[model samples]
Target: MVDADQTFVIVGGGLAGARAAETLRAEGFSGRVILIGDERDHPYERPPLSKGYLTGKAERESVFVHEPAWYARSDIELHLGQPVTAVDRSRKTVTLGDGTTIQYDKLLLATGAEPRRLEIPGTELAGVHHLRRLAHADRLQGVLAALGRDNGHLVIAGAGWIGLEVAAAARGYGAEVTVVEPAPTPLHQVVGPELGQVFTDLHARHGVRFHFGARLTGITGQDGMVLAARTDDGEEHPAHAVLAAVGAAPRTALAESAGLALVDREHGGGIAVDASLRTSDPDVYAAGDVAAALHPLFRTRLRVEHWANALNGGPAAARAMLGREVSYDRVPYFFSDQYDLGLEYSGWAPPGSYDQVVLRGDVARREFIAFWLKDRRVLAGMNANVWDVTDTVQALIRSGEPVDPEALADPGTPLDTVLPRA
Candidate 1:
């Protein structure tokens, strides 16, 4: 058994790292916990960075998870602006950017993910941005402040959550926004085409131009100023600034160097962790976007890059590191705000596996709930401004009982009515 005062080193200071530290303290672990982060600021909410925070509706201080005093009170030793350069797993020590070494009884990796890059010309040009950190948000905020409702042109690549949120933020600045996505419909991968069509309609109503099925050819700039983005279809559009929201890849360099097993799928690269979020090495624990967790419900490997997952996975990883046998089987849920619409999605639908989809409300009003069914059982469901049934649907899906699609589609039918009594 390890001493209560044993030092615990946590890498990455985002939600995962912060949550792990907080959970450790809450669990009565009075150990020396050192959080190493490359960024200088305290852990802040990242979801708002692409929406309210970026649009200037929220201040930087408002997004911070905890004040400076909270970390001190919690006794979490924070080493800010210091990146971990190397990890000697054999020695059980990590070398920091400044060459400082810290020995750890246990290590929790929550490094998270980084924005994927577009390796074309003009990517390095001025006015090109990616929103992942507070610093990036600050920069974009400064740009919005500078433009000041002057009908500026903002070209954004990718139509994922971040891209759409950025578009909303840019539109709030009164800028002419155009989004380019390679998918046939925005959110095609997540919600499928039927719901994606509804999302597309909402954006179109708000004047967000989408260049669907458009391939990025290159970005071009003249004298350090971004001029336009060229599509593979041989079309060029003028823009004042370009934002690349092409999604993110797991930051697993440190994990790979430590000889951790990684599940390199066709989609991306991420360190592979078991049901309990443990790497091949038993002493090492990983969570958040960096660790690809296996979903027991789907009986397949899945990685969620959502705020809820990051917040919950961190503590779950900490628990595992603390020798607590627990399975991280929480139902995955995520929210996205764009164009005055709030979208809440829960659970998963394996590709083309859902046999039927039930809609609870009118799609034209932009408020509805769509449930995916497999063999008359609820597999997954999404709510658009209809979050009341989130808990009910979550329970029903996890109930492992077959649900009648007809009942789910009937708006007059209450969700609990269909649920089997406990």
Candidate 2:
């Protein structure tokens, strides 16, 4: 067995990288752990960037996952503001943008995903923005703060989680918010049309304008600032600022260039891993959004970019590196906070797979729980302001119970009573 004091190099200082380092220390591996990140700041919580932090309700000091002192105290070296340009797999060394090279015994590619940009004419316009990193939020906050003084029109492209949350936040700041989604409803990708309607109604109630099923053609700018956008339908919409939240693709360039086997190239797919999150290369492991793990429950390969997945999978990958193979069974979960509402969802029930849906509360009121049943098995759970249903639905999923549709929709029945104890 190799000595733990040899070396452990982690790329990307996101939640996954930070947690993996912490977990490694806890697992009794005292090694020269080095974390490399392109971002200047230390690892901080990301979910808040679209929620309390964007709304200015949360302070900058509260955003960090741990104080700088924590990493120093734990003996984890942080290489910030330096992007890893290349990896020499033959020699087991990574070269940074500044031409610094470091060798590693065990390498973890925790390189998180990046926000995708629409390839349109006015993409380089001054007012065009994307909300992914802390620097992005800082710039957006500045734009919004300036807009507050004068009623500014904020146009958001793609109505995904970040787009919708930004819409809600901009609206709260009194900016005229418009969300452009190619689909008929927002959240169609995650919750399906039935529940997507629920979200649409919620955003509608908040005075947000929705341009469903409209494709953005190109942005028109004047003097490097955006003025309007042309739609696929040949219609032009005026806008003061534009935000593109279409989606994100994994950052797999480093892994791919180093002769790592990637699942797909067109979509920027990541290193395919087994049950223990070990990549095809035995010495290399991956976790978080960049790693695609085999889903035992879904019986498929999925790369989940959820908060819970990063939190749990990070530690699991580190344990695997320590020669302890532990399979991650935690259901993939994510939460979105939009305009006084909390949306929490667990498990994956890809759209069109479910034949029936069970409603626990009123969707119109924005307080409800939607259970997706595929062949009478609880495949997914979506709740808005009804957080208590998570454990119940998760238990049912774990139990693999063939719950009756009638029992699922019954509000009178206690959720716990319906689910098996333990």
> Candidate 1, residues 106-220: lDDT per residue as tens digits?
9988999999888888888888999999999999987766654667788899988888888777777778878899899988878888778887887778788999999677888
Looking at model 2, which ten-residue stretch has the lowest summed lDDT? 261-270
- CA deviation > 4 Å runs, candidate 2: 1-4, 265-268, 420-422
- TM-score for each predicted model, relative to the true structure: 0.96, 0.96
- Report residue 139 deviation for candidate 2 (angstroms): 0.6
Clashes of each: 0, 0
340: Cα error in model 2, Å:
1.6
TM-score of 2: 0.96
- What are the lDDT figures for the candidates, one per model? 0.85, 0.85
Clashes of 2: 0
Residue 219's lDDT within candidate 2 is 92
